[model samples]
Target: MAVLLVGTVVVLPSPQSTLAAWTATEYGRGSLQAGTVNPPTNLQCSAGVLTPPTFTWTLPAAGGLTRTGFTWSLSGGFTGGGTLGATATSVTVPGGLLGIGSGTFRLVANGPGGWTSTPVTGTLGMLTAILYSCSVP
Candidate 1:
């Protein structure tokens, strides 16, 4: 009489199957561009008491984003006291806010994606004399 013995073996998958199943991938990043704003040139004031001085400016091209808005600062004791249009590139200083003194004024434009343009400064002064001359009284 003869006796024979056989053995069988089984293999199991790794416990980290979910982590190994993920594959590597490549991704691209977007770029944020900057924009610019033209400074106000040839500023002039009016003699009329309630008339405000007007300042004009040109909008510069933005790389690939839209212009959000603009901020203005005045010198010569001038105060900004008006609302600007959504796309307005011009502003007028109230009569009562001007004629205080002579100084510099600046403006800057805000672009999309938190980008700002170079500030534009100008030599701003009273183009016209005060409406009420103290010497007259």
Candidate 2:
């Protein structure tokens, strides 16, 4: 409201804002080829569950175009595993160096700048055969 004081016109200042606006620049982005590449799906464990564990899975059709390598690991039963080239679709974790009973397995796709795909995991049952399938069959 405005007021006229003794022939003089007076006006009030509007309220001040408490917040301020700022600007920033984007640095990067993340991707998984629409969930088709990293942490390959359709994981399958061969009939060999005794000596060591051999696991395989499917990757995106363009997997070789992006992925550099694959990392596999076995936990729960013991603690052992290794990395393989992108050309290979399966991994055979060495005997936990010290293992027993059932266990768990994990896999991931290796990428640049500490980039890794979502992990694929599964339970590992007890060994059923003396001759492992990863190395022999």
Candidate whose TM-score is highest:
2
Query: What Cα-based lDDT does every candidate model obtain?
Result: 0.53, 0.66
Give the TM-score of each candidate: 0.49, 0.57
Q: How far does residue 107 in candidate 1 sit from its true spot (Å)?
A: 1.4
**Against the hidden true structure, what lDDT does model 1 obtain?**
0.53
Encode model 2's per-residue lDDT on 1-137: one tens digit a residue.
Answer: 99876776789999998777667766777865533345676787764535565687887356433787888876774677788887778876665343346667778887665678888787665544353433121
Give the range of the ten consecutive residues with the poorest summed lDDT in model 2: 128-137
Q: Against the true structure, what is every candidate's RMSD?
A: 15.6, 12.4
Cα deviation in Å at residue 111, candidate 2? 1.1
Tens-digit lDDT track of model 1 for 1-137: 99898989989977664545657897999996543443233333332443444556766553434566767776656666333443776765555556745555566666656565576665444556654211000
Q: What TM-score number comes out for model 1?
A: 0.49
Which numbered prediction scores highest in lDDT against the true structure? 2
Positional deviation of 73 in candidate 1, in angstroms?
1.3
For model 1 the local lDDT of residue 66 reads: 57
